[model samples]
Structures are given as C-alpha cells and as structure tokens.
Target: MPKDTMTAEQRLQTVIRLGVPDRVPVDPMIYYFAAYYANITVHELWSDMKKYEFAINKCFNELGPWDIYYPINPISPEAYMFILPMKMKLAGLDLPPDEINQVIEEEIMSADEYLTFARSKTPTTFLKYINFLSTLACRVQREQQGEGIFAKTRIIRKMLKQIPVWREEFKRWQARDVAVQHGICMEAPFDTLSMSRGLVSFSYDLMDNPGPLAEVSLALSKGYVKVGDWLTKKTGVRRVLVFCHRTSNDFVSPKQFEQHAFPSLKAIVNGFVERGVTPFLHCDGNWNKNLEYLYELPKGKVVLQFDGRTDIFRAKEIIGGHCCIFGDVPASMLAFGGKEEVTEYCKKLIEKAGKGGGFILAAGCEVAPNARPENVKAMLDSVKKFGYYS
Candidate 1:
C-alpha cells in the first residue's frame, strides 16, 4: 500500500466533500468509555482531566493510533448545556458514577404548555422555562453536594475551573497531529419534546395535538442554529454536532418521521450549512427507512453518523456520495467479542461501506466502559491493515 499522502484533517475533509482520500479515518466516540478503558471511573475523568489525558494518550499509542481525537470535555457534561434542557438522573449525582446514567424520561412540560409555547412570538417564553429550570438545578446541586449556603457557590466554582482541561486536550491532540472531534453540541427539537413530555405522552401529543408540537419543534431548531452559530464564532470551530435519535424509523413510523421529525431536523441541519458550518449528526437509533430521506439534505455538507441500530451497508448504497457516513461498529462486539470476531466484522465494514469514500470507522455509538482492550485494538488495527486506498 502507498504511504499516507494527506494530513488527518485533509483526509476527513476529503470524505466530507464526497471524494476519496488516501485512507479511511477511524473516529471512535470514546466518551465515558475512555475512563472505563483506562480503569478510571467516569467521575475521576471529569475531576482530574490531566490524568484522563494521559490515559487516553496511552490508549492511542498502545491500542489505537486512531484517527480523530475525541476531546475530554473541559466542562462537566452533567451540567445544563443542552439546547432544550430537562432533568436527568445524572452520573455521580443520582446514580453511581461509573454506571450508565438515565434520562429520567419523566414529564417536564404539561399538555397545556404546548399552545403557549407555540403562540409566543419571542424567546422570552423559552428563556423563562430555562431560567426556572436552571435555578432548580442550582438547588439540586446544592442539596446533592452540601447543605451550607456557600456549598452551591463552591461547586459552581469548580465546574468553571475545568475549562483549561479542554484547552489542554485540544492543544495536546493538535500537537500530536490527531484531528480533534468536538464542536457546538445541539439536539433535534422533536427529540427534546419526547424526553420533556415523556415518550408515551409525547406520542399522544403527536396524535391529538400535532400542530403545537410541530410549531415548538420548528422554533427550537431555529433557536439551536442561533446558539450554535454564536458558539461556533467563539470556539472558532466550524462544526455543529446535532444529536438525533427519537426521529429514527425504529422510534416512529416513516410517515410520522417525515411529518414531525424530518422537517425540523432538516431545518436545523440546513440552517447550519447555510451559515457555512458542517453539521455532524449523531444518529442514535435505526434509520433504515429514513435513509432515502437523508438525501434531502444538502449534498456533501452534512455527516450522518450511525449507531449499530442503523443498517450501515444499505446506508452506503443510499447516501454514499450525497453525504459522509460515520460509524456502525457494535459496542457489544467491542466489549464481548474476541479479537478475531471484531476483526472480521471490521473487515466486512471496510470492504462494503468503505469501498469508495466518505466512511469513518467508529464504534457504533461509543466504546463501552467494559470493552475489551484487545477487541478495541483489533478494531483500530483493521484500518491500517485493510483501510488504505491505492
């Protein structure tokens, strides 16, 4: 095979532009798993990030040398940074730090709040809820951390102090010639609604009160663009990470997806593309029936990343040239399968989804906290063995 002829960013951008690069880039989304793979608890990763960085580098040098650096978030992810923030059973707070956290799936918005939300012309109504929730969060923090008046103040102070950790992560990765994977994070409005109203209630709302839900979703997508744009300017990274799972074909019927999900999602995606920023969608569910719908997006401007739930092979058939595809390696395989089992699956992925261009090899969603190191190494090494292009 020929030696690499492009830089890491060049290779990634090549796929983004719908062109073949020297090789396929591997971009595993190693979130809490990073802490797990290193035998460090998730909470420890957030609390002592320099330690996190060292362990991550060790993973790369020993088992990885993977393309794209997944940044150790400087800000604690447990905090309220979501576009449509809602209560969650956060790790290290409501649950064990290392255990998978829950979304609570409880209702925050009542049935009556929908009309008022849609009718209001300004963001004041939205901000009012956010302010109320934020204050509630402060008390939650104070109660969880301590009982003193200055307890909340002390905890808030510590959260702000982690910004340097992210800077260090970025600097270290850039210095090492690895591409950093981070940007302004946002979510699809419909998904937010599902979580806020609870899925069962939201499904009823979809049936009986579709109009307001649609209107609220549209407004939230627009709001996301505004917030994402401002953050992009501040961060100087021209990428937007949009998390969309509730709209997938497996979650809702095709007709419902097109009606309630696709429109608002397309609006948010195109909104970012229009502003010259790339929207990297973190698709969290099966999207088989919705693959054709993705072609409605601007050609070569957006990335449709899949978890294991999506059929990546058929996806390559549908949107190969129209958009870049990332991921589909099952986390189960990484955490349980033998090295040979993992390697065979990866080779299959390379031969099929990677035959042309516009493919990124990554764990379907994220590397599991209990993923076998040998299996991860096998996944990482497959690219070097079979990923190169002539």
Candidate 2:
C-alpha cells in the first residue's frame, strides 16, 4: 500500500506488515504523555477526557506519528497501576499499626468477592472501595519489592454465573459507540483476585486450589471474549492490545506461567481470532523466557508491545514475522537521552526490525508522565528521517 493511500487503520496494518512508510509510525502508549503535554496532573487525566483529548492532539500534531491509542476510558482502567490490592488504616482508626492491621484484616473480603463484584447488576459503592484497596496494595508491593507481586498472589475465582452481568454492561458500552475500540480488556481479573485475597495467600492457592484457579481464569476469558466480540461488532475495531504487568517473564518461570496463566490467555486470543479480531499482547519485562509459547499463536495475527526489559533484537528475530512487534524506545531513555540518542536508537531499530514487515514503533510501554516534549520530537523526527522504504 502506498503511504499516501493509507487510512489511519491501514497505515497501522502496513507497519504491522513490516512495510516501511513515508515515516515510522509514532504510537506512544500515551497516558502520562497526555498529562505532561496538557500540563495537568495524573488525577485530572483520569477524570477529564476533554483535557486528555487536548493532550493527545498536542502530542499527535507536534509529533506526527501513526495511529493514537485514543483511550476508551479515562486513562486505561485495565492497567495494573490503577488496580492494586492493599489495605491501609483509614483515618481515625486510632490503633497501633499492628492492632489497626488486625481490625482491617478481619474485614478482608473473601475470593468470592471477585465474582460478586463482577456479577453486580449495578456497581456498588463497596465494589469501588475494594477496587481502591486493590490499587493501593499493588502500588505498595511494587514500591517495597521493586517488582510487581500480584502475579504470585492469590485470587478468588468466581463461578461462571457471575460473569453474564458484566458482559451485559459491555454490550451497553458497545451499543453506545463509546469508542471505536474497547480495550483488550474491560478490567483485570487476576488483579481483582489479588485484592480479595492477599498476594502470599493467593500464590499458595495456585498450588492448593489449582482447580478453582483454572476455573476462574477460564471464566474471566469468557467475559473478555464477549466484550471483544461486542467491541468488534460495534466499531469494527477488531484489533486489540491486551496488557499484563505481573505476569512478565521476569516474574514467572515458564513452567509456572504456562500452567497458571497461558491456558486462559490462549483461550482469549484464540477466541478473538476465531471471531476475526486481532489479539495484541501487551507484556512488559523479559519475554525471552516464553518465546516458544508466544510463537505458538498464529503468525501475523497478533501484536506484541514490549517494555524496555524485553530484548527487542531477539524478539524481532523470533516473532517479528508472525506478529507485529512494537516498542523498545524506553520512556526513561527518552526522558533523559535527548534528541541525538533517541534518533540513533530509532534508526537502529528500523534497520534491524523493519525488515520483511510486521513492526511498529512505540515506547516500551507508555510515554511516562514526565517524558520531555523534545524527546518525543526526537522519536518522530528519526522515524520520518529514516523510516521510508525505497
């Protein structure tokens, strides 16, 4: 396809084919990038779509890259950063740390709370409180452990009956033409489980309650499949990027990952493809450990978005032909590396990965909240200067 002839969606398809364009596509996972460009706080970005739209335009018009993520919800609700599970003593509890912990600990909800929350005909205020606690827990673990702990935590698996209600809400979201695409996920199931059951308890349950765990995961994917189908039907946007933070290669060994995680994920991806929807995996950290399994998916039918921890060179050689390979320009580097380094890195990626098609340029994950405007300029500039095919 000629560069000038491409539509926004078509241009993305071309890049996925590994075909060079008039320029390399710029599709930074914009969340913080939007906030910084708009000169607002992260909180505002989450609550105000108009402000977010302005920020997205600022980056897009100034940077001039490929298709934008164009979030369906205010800041992606699916991201783990927004859904940790920890409890803190609310103000005026007036107990020592140990006693306060015990009091709240007694109130801790069981794994069934996950399904109850998901199955609610209407969202409850208590559900919101649980969601907040989960987010706080995830944040605290990351801060204390220096890596995400949610993957190893215990999650309560709900019965299949609880899922239909959530699916109905998704249908409603679809009927509205809410966004051309709904996220690969409307919510994080595993993250939800972790909040109801703490991480340590959850990890043990994987061994102790493998049957229940497996059942829950299957149920979760079933929910996602309905959502994915509805999104595709409504907007004709079948391409989706599903994200996972705690399940990265660095966090889970192959044996453990394949056993606990892969089954449901594979089902979700297959479900999407069977319905003519594309499944793009948004996995950060080192995926080197699971390359063989990742390759098991249909070639050129899926997309992989990586964080800096992924080996882009090796990933290009491995899955570049079968799936669209996106990202590797680390956000932190863009924040500190300045224009010259950014240009060189992008050029090198183009030369190596942009061969034989199926590559897209993006940040390792998101353009961080504080990434410099000039660094973003450098990325777009480099792609334009070097991304054209002869």
Candidate 3:
C-alpha cells in the first residue's frame, strides 16, 4: 500500500523465507481480548458466527496494521465437536453469556487405552471424534443439567449454519492485500497427549509407562500429518502452526524430551514439509535444552516462534540467521509496563533480533486481556521507528 519494496503479506513472507524484509513484521497472538475490546461476551463471539466475524473485523479495524492476521479460537462450528471438545460457560449452550470457554483437560483414556489406540487399525478421526463426543457428553451432563439435550442441539444447528459463512469470511480476508491470514493450526504429538491426558497423568505415563506413551506419541504424530493434509486441502493454505507446549524444558528433563518428544516432532515436521506446507513451530516455554534439535529439521522451511519463557536472544544466536525467529516480549510487560518501558524494550528487541532479516516483532505469547492498548500501540509504533531495513 505504501509502495514499499514488499506488501505487508510479502514482508511477512520474506521473513518466513528467512530473508530480511524492508521492515520487521508486527504479529501478535490475539484471542479473548478481541471480544473484550468489542464489548461482547466471549460466549457471543464463539457461539454466534456472525457476531464472531463482526468482532474479529472490529479488532482488525481498531488494532491492526499487522502483517499477519490470526483469528484465534472459536475457529468454526465443526471445530466445537471435532477439534476442540472443551466445555465452559460460554462454549456450552446452557452456561451464561459472560462465562468464558475453557479447554477441559482430563485423561479420557487409560494407559492401556493408549496402547489400544496405537495398535488399532481404525481411522484416527473416528477415534478422536468418539473421544470428543464422549467428553462433550460428560460436560453436558455436568453443566447442562436438564437443558443439555436442547442446548447441544441448538449449538450444533448454529455451527452447521455457519460453516459456509465462515468459509466466506476466510475468502474475504484472503482477498485483502494488506494482511495475510494465518493458516491451519496443529499441535505436536506430545502436546496433544498432554491435552488429552491431563498434565499430571501424562507425566506419570511418561515416567511409569514409557513404552505405551512412545507408541501413542508416534500414532498421534501420524494422525497429525493426516489432519494437516486434510486441513491444507480444506483451507487452501500451506502453513501449519505446530504448537509444542509440554515438551519444553520447564516440563521435562533433556533426556526425557529427547527420548519422547523429539522423534515425533521430527516426524511431524518432516511430514508437513513433504506435503509442501511450511511448519511454524510455536514452541512455548523454556526450550533452551532443545534448541539444538531444531537444527535437525529442514532449513528455511520452518519458522520458530517463542513465548516469553524462552531466551529468544540465545535462540537468535543458536538458529538466528538460519531460521526466522518470532518473539519474546513478556506478556507481563505489555500488561503492566508503561509506554516508555514497552517502547524501550521493543527497541532493544529490534536491535538484537531484527539485526538480521528474519525476525518478526511480537509479544512472547498472546497479548493478555489486561494488556494496555497504549502498550500495544507502542509495540506497533516501535516497529515503524526501529524495524526498518533501509
């Protein structure tokens, strides 16, 4: 739009391609805050498709100038029954409009069940859907009381009607030249296990029953590739965000991670790469111990994004010029730090990570609900002031 060397989309693509762009792209992970700013309850945003689109567009109008636009959560109606099985105040129909949707993390499968899944010839989708429905039923029972049946039917109807609407919304965003729509999001196998089996249970499984856990991890990795392929075909986007949370150093020792996490992660990355999609690794938490393993994956085909927990500067030194590195601005700073504090910190981040061409400026994680709008403004402003390649 400004007649720069690259369009906003091109600017982001340049960094993703491991080349320096005319300026560093400003991309932040945004979620609940969108509804917060739009003056709508999270329930309305996720339950009603039309309102969801309106609120997201409102967020774009109000907070943007961003290179990449990520429509975080309440992805689609089918997503409710399939990809996300969590039930909370806003997500489940019986709850109040003000209640927030939350991911229900419980070990739905026993240790032997994991082994059974690994050995079964059944389609992973069938298994996952069955498990999701079971979990949803359980949630409905607990939260819906007598209204469960009616509420569930209403929610499903709403979702079914919105499928086409959501597709059209994505098409409209894709037509916009100023911003790139983020593609499909997938999680690494280990993280999937952590979510399916509560962290405590998964931790125990890892230590007490490593064999079944490893088998299940491999099975999940294979399933993810199939899922990624399906999503790529469905959405026509070739980028996948492979979220890896529990695999971080905060949760496991180096040996445990190498044994259980790295193999499946490698498989998933390779599987996606083989299918002609770029994998963007959202490796949250302290991954200092596993930084070296990232190098083992194919170069220039992956973008590594870190939450504030990881030492991104060290990451820059380890993989900086070779791979595109996305963030580390503490969410806490964005939430409580003054404008000047935010500005200075951003400047330093740019000077260090933006020195080469492959860094994108962003908060370590999602800009929290309490994050000051002025601080966010400061973040965008700092990029304009210091992120230029000249």
Name the best candidate (by TM-score).
1
Could you give candidate 3's per-residue lDDT for residues 1-390 as a string of tens digits?
233577877887788778888888887667666677777887777767677777767766776756676655554444553343333334445566655665556665456667665666655653542333343444433344332456556555544454455455656776775454345665576776666677788888888887776667777676677766766566656777777867899988889888888888988889888988788888888998889878888887788889888888899999886778888778899889999999999998899988878888887877776788788778877777888888
In terms of lDDT, the poorest run of 10 residues in model 3 is 81-90
**Regions of candidate 2 where Cα sits further than 4 Å from its true position:** 1-5, 17-23, 70-72, 75-184, 187-196, 207-209
Top candidate when judged by lDDT against the true structure: 1
TM-score of each predicted structure versus truth: 0.88, 0.71, 0.86
Clash number for model 2? 17
Every model's Cα RMSD, please? Answer: 3.8, 9.7, 4.1
TM-score of 3: 0.86
Q: In what order do the candidates fall by TM-score, top score first? A: 1, 3, 2
Whole-structure CA lDDT of model 1: 0.74
Whole-model Cα lDDT of every candidate shown, in order = 0.74, 0.59, 0.71
Model 1, TM vs. native = 0.88
Error at 10, model 1, angstroms: 0.7
Query: How would you encode candidate 2's per-residue C-alpha lDDT over 1-390 as one tens digit per residue?
Result: 334444445656666555555545556666666666767655455445556557666776676544545343323222333333444332123333112122122224455544454444535433433333343444433234322335223221111222343344445434532222233343334534544466566666666665555456555676566665664555445666575655666655777678867777788888778888876677867888887788778766777888889888898887787777888789888887877888889989888877655777777787765778888777766656777665
